[model samples]
Target: MPNERLRGAVSARELTTQRCAELLGVDPKTVERWITRDRVPHRAHRVAAADLLGVDETYLWPSVVDDLRTVSAGRAEMVEFYPSRSAVPLELWRSLIQQARESVDILVFAGLFLPELHDITQLGERARQGCRIRVLLADPNGAAVRRRGDEEGFGVGLAHRVLLSLRYYEPILAIPGVEVRLHDTTLYASIFRVDETMLVNTHVYGSTAAHNPVLHLRRVPGGRVVDHYLTSFDRVWTHAKRTSDINAVIAAFDGR
Candidate 1:
């Protein structure tokens, strides 16, 4: 059977077999055989081709699961773990944001510490340099925010913090390639993605985010953890309100 997945991935990227061969340092016929004959490439080529096609190696070749399981690829994706979100170094956070070439995505209820740690204006410089920056905050007017506040014994304080965080993010909202959205969903984890590296803060009941454990994950071929979080981010991003709607909500809250 033909390897439709490989064929589709290459086609989706508009890469010809010859181009892929050139990049993979293989003969063009070999590339065609991998797709048409379902020939599994060597481990190195599998990794290289997957990275180039922007998909997991297993997605292209399901039978190549032995190496992933043997190496514990999921655990390998973890670069570090902090006892709590507060335990993550400020320098590490700064370095991640500063080094990001492609994207910076933040998903949180408030995440007020971000503005406190780094000047939010610096994100504009990143956007100018062609980094796509996305900030997803819990909508102050949403039920989830209120519920979170009550759960944390903060009452309306959490909502207020969200408003304040939005204020800090206000300037960057108008910048090209920088998007701010309001999500009302129950947040299980707060994800801070700097390209392929992510810091995932897992939420616990009745605990503030500062007290939550953070897993620092970098994407690895055949790993599923990072992709799971990325999919969650996309789902939330899809249904979230745009900047104009969030601004109106903030304005209304301020007026009252």
Candidate 2:
């Protein structure tokens, strides 16, 4: 059963289309359009829905539950922005994954799984070392891969270049001890958990995320942080569609 606390705090009654439109200050036809497009009440309407339900707007969107909880505790979270062209220096990211002994679960958005850029080869080595390594990444697609090519020409056609970017990380995915999944969500961040410690790297460029901040969430075990991350990862993984026909390498571990 869902938490009674959560249910008691939130009203489950579904609002009518007309009622929802009235709350959002939009014409009923506009609401119908949103339904047709599947965009729903969206961010703007979220606020109004919360007011209607007499609950925190976060309640309407299950994802925001963590943010609401985090804020209520007076925890400080930073948001940093950087231009798209300049690379983000995240050395801690490498260290976290490299030293994992028991398990490593990673969630990344716009991460180039390249051996040269990062020690992706090390992931395979760790996998062979009997550590559980799972990576969830955004799928390369129209909007996702659009900027990669225009930023720098990798001497390949648009599609091939995108494929190459994804292929470069195949060694990590092919590792028998690792599970790789491609997710399609705007939640652009990676959580690398090494046992009890968690390092969250937020990779963003341009307007969507300014000064992409990497949040390091730390607390002892049983705080429910790691469990929450695992749940989120699984949600993305189960919904993610698998990528097919990964390139084969002569020296698989070597990433040749």
Candidate 3:
């Protein structure tokens, strides 16, 4: 049977067999065989081709599940772990945002530290440079925010902090390629993803997010950890309300 997944991935990338071969340093006939004859390439070629096509290697070759090395590579996805979110270096945060070429996706309650630590204008600049940015902040007026506030002993302060953070984001909300949404869902983890690399801050009961542990993950082929969080982010984003009128959102919260 032909490897339709490989054929589709290459076609989706608009890459001809000859172009794929050129990039992979293989003959066009070999590339064709991989797709038409369902020939599984060597481990190195598998990784390289997957990276080029922007899909998991296993998706192209299901037989990879039997490869223990591929499973090991998935576990290696966690690049580092910080004892607390505050323990992460400021430079590292800046580097991650600065190096992003494709997308920057953030899901948090307030994430007030972001605009405070780094100039939020950089996000606008990034959007202008063709990078898609999506930010999901908790709805200040929602029950989830109030409940989180009570859990953290912040009362109504968490809502206020989210408002303040929204002010910082207001200017960039109108930027093309940038989207800001408000989600009322209980956020289990705060995700800051810059392209394939992500910083995941896991929330704990009765603890402030700044004190929470953070996992630094870079997406690797067949990695389940990063994809799991990414999927969560997308789910929240789907149900989140897009904020087009910043003043209206604030007014609604204030009126409530």
Best by lDDT: 3
TM-score per candidate, chains pooled: 0.75, 0.52, 0.76
Best of the two (2, 3) by lDDT: 3
- Where model 2 places Cα greater than 4 Å from the true spot, the runs are 1-91, 113-117, 142-162, 203-205, 208-210, 247-256
The sequence of per-residue lDDT tens digits that candidate 3 reaches over residues 20-62 is 9999999999999999999999988997998799777778998
Across residues 217-253, which tens digit of lDDT does each residue of candidate 1 receive?
A: 9998657689779978989999998874556877777
- lDDT for each residue of candidate 2 in 13-41, tens digit (9 for 90 to 100): 55666776677688877755544543334
Kindly indicate the candidate among 1 and 3 with the higher lDDT. 3
lDDT by candidate, in order shown: 0.91, 0.54, 0.92
Question: What are the clashing pairs of model 1?
Answer: none
List the RMSD of every prediction in angstroms.
4.4, 12.3, 5.3
- Indicate the TM-score of model 1: 0.75
Question: Higher-TM-score candidate among 1 and 2?
Answer: 1
Q: After the best TM-score superposition of candidate 1, give how far the Cα of residue 194 lies from its true spot, in angstroms.
A: 0.3
> Model 1's lDDT to the true fold?
0.91
**Preferred candidate (lDDT higher): 1 or 2:** 1
